[model samples]
Target: MFDSIKLRKQHGYQAIRDIRTATVKAPFRGFPRLDGEKCDLSCLACTAVCPTGAIATEPLRIDLGRCTFCGECERGCGTGAIQFSSAHSLASTDRNDLIIQSGQTPESFRETAIQSRREIHRLFGRSLKLRQVSAAGCNGCEMELNAANNVNFDMGRFGIEFVASPRHADGIVITGPISRNMAPALKDAYLSISEPRIVVAVGTCAISGGIFADSAQLDRSFLDEVPVDLYIPGCPPHPLTIIGGLLDFRRHK
Candidate 1:
């Protein structure tokens, strides 16, 4: 028991108290920085190498919604025209706002990406329960979301939790590209939830289909059919980003 206590003491405070100021480790790409003037107009190497069509030249733009947070665009560029920053707060209320143009930084993106939702705060401010639906996710986003509720993140302290059923949920969080096979089930789950519910799309797949956007098997038309309140962009968003996005959306000033 003494040895266990010693180990616990050595671990110190596991949960992060302030997610906004927390720093992520190196090489964990979160946001892209694009410099249009530095790029060679004749070369389209960055776009060619990108598995997803997240990169585009002609003034250079990267859509975080479709980005997998992969560093291929950075490695493909010879003139250092593209690189990634470690900023993880990439959630946005507007889908078009995820596009990063020249002269934009992740620091700047945060200002407008999240807007204060007074109506939503009034509904689920003190307590929020969510139902997670994985349509056809590769499980990468699912794993990171699971980490958000672990002891290290301790999201429960804020009265946020994932419930077992949609009937008990205050909102729905979706992961994956919404394949045709899973569309009906996903819709049924959404309809099962009580009224005044919101929808949160997590990961590049859920937000914009990531690398699988072109896949013929997907039925993302469901997204057009229903309203989405939040869009969290990343190949697999960090736990801090997920927690911070939720807190920022519902927390009172």
Candidate 2:
């Protein structure tokens, strides 16, 4: 028991005291800030180096859903057209809203980010149990999702957590591009869960196939079969970003 107390002091209170308003202090690039005036149509430098084609020039919009948050565009652009910020609350209910247009700051996105899915709130009632499907991912996003449930994030305190079985879950959290091999298994997992279920596309791969959209090995039929309730945009979204989205989706905020 004495060892436990010492461990507690050494670790301190790791979880964010207030997940809703907590700001990330690290050199993490959570959101991209776009400047249309600085964007040069002739150069097209940003688009050329973008691995996932997340950036488009006509209206100067960066789709967060496809973004890996690698900061490649910021480095290649000389006009300061794109700069990434530490603002991490980048989840949304609508897929279209993930597209960040020029002159759109993190603050601007926050205004519409989580529109409070009232019906979901009524269905879940401030608690959720999810079954996560790796779907042949690189494991970066999978590691981050595990981190979301750790002592530091402590998402369970809010009554949100992952379950071992789909039968025991309120929904399924999908990561990675759904490979052709995993398609049938992914469908089976979803079918195991009860109705009034939620589907969350938690990373760039699951949302828009990330860097593998053109790859022939992916079969993303499950995405078309059901509507995604929340879209968390990041290579692997921050733990705060994930938990906060779940809370906002359930209208806990």
Candidate 3:
């Protein structure tokens, strides 16, 4: 007991008191900032090296939904036109908002990415129980989702939790790119949840299939079939991003 007490004192308040104001590590990649004017007319380097076809010239846009956050675009750009910032508050209700264009900053873009919904708050104001489905996920998003419940993040304190069964869940959180083999099961899980349920697409894969968008084995048609309440964009979204997104979803009404 004495040893346990000593350890407890060593790590006081492991969880973040306020996720909204907390800052992620400088090395972590959350959002991409584009600078189209910096590019030379002959250069198409960023687009050529992009694995997910997320980059497009003319106006210069980087789709956060398809980005793996690998920072490869930054490496490929010699003019420093594309850079990734450490801002982790990357969640959106609309898919189109995930596209980052030239002259946009993460801080500025975030202002319009999320919106207040009365129905969402009225349903899940106090407590929200979610069932996570990894439809052919690489386990990257799954790991981060698990970390949201750890001591450091402690998402449960805000009345959010991941339940074992879909029947007991208030909503479903979908990860991965949704493979052909897993599509049916994914639909079944959504059907299993009770009405007034919400759906959150987490990570780049779930949002826009990431690098696997064009894979023959993947099937992302499920998103089109059902309405998604939230889209959390990241290669593997940070725990803070996941937690903050969820809280904002339930709050701000």
Candidate 4:
């Protein structure tokens, strides 16, 4: 007992005290704030460099659901018109909310990001069990989702966790583009979960097929067939974004 106590004290508090208001440091790109006024109409440098067609010119906008947060758009643009901030709390239940326009702040994006459903709060505010489906993911998002349950994040403490089977889940968290081969399995998993179940799309690939949207092997029909309860955008969304998104989605107040 003394040895255990000594070890515990040595490590101190490892997890973030608060997920909602915590600040993420440099290198991890979160929100893309676009400056449309500075854009040179002739130059499509940002658009050209984007792998997923996530950038739009004329009235510049970025689709977060399609974005990999690759930093390519910011780096390739010579006009200093784009920047990716370290504000990782970007997640929304509405697909249109992910389409960020120029001059939009994280605060503004967050204000209407989630208009939580009363039924959702009633059913899952206190506890949420999710079955994760990788679909055809590269596993980057899967790894981060795993980290959300680790000692540092401790998502399970709030009663949000991933289960081994869809039979035990209240919802399904999907992490990849719905590939042709994985479509049936994905549908099966969602069906296995009881009613009042949600569908959460995590990462750019799952939400908009990432760079693989045009791929003939992908069958993203599942997204069209089912309504997604939440969309957490990133190539592989940060664990904070994942946990924070879920929390915000279930908050009634």
Each candidate: what lDDT? Answer: 0.89, 0.89, 0.89, 0.91
Best candidate according to lDDT: 4
User: Which TM-score value belongs to model 4?
Assistant: 0.95
lDDT of 4 by residue, 1-253 (tens): 9999999899998988886677889877998888999999789999899999999998999999998888999999988889898988889999999999999988888889988989999999899999999989999999999999998999999999889999999999998887899999999999999998999999999999998889999998988899998999988899999988999999998
Any residue pairs clashing in model 3, and if so which?
none
Where does candidate 3 stray beyond 4 Å? none
Candidate 1: where is the Cα deviation over 4 Å? Answer: 1-12
> Which residue pairs of candidate 4 clash?
none
Off by over 4 Å in 2: 1-5
Candidate 3 per-residue lDDT, tens place, 39-73, comes to 76478888889999988888788888888888887
Question: Where in model 4 is the C-alpha error above 4 Å?
Answer: 1-9
Q: What is the TM-score (0 to 1) of candidate 1?
A: 0.94
Better of 1 and 4 by TM-score: 4
Clash count, candidate 4: 0
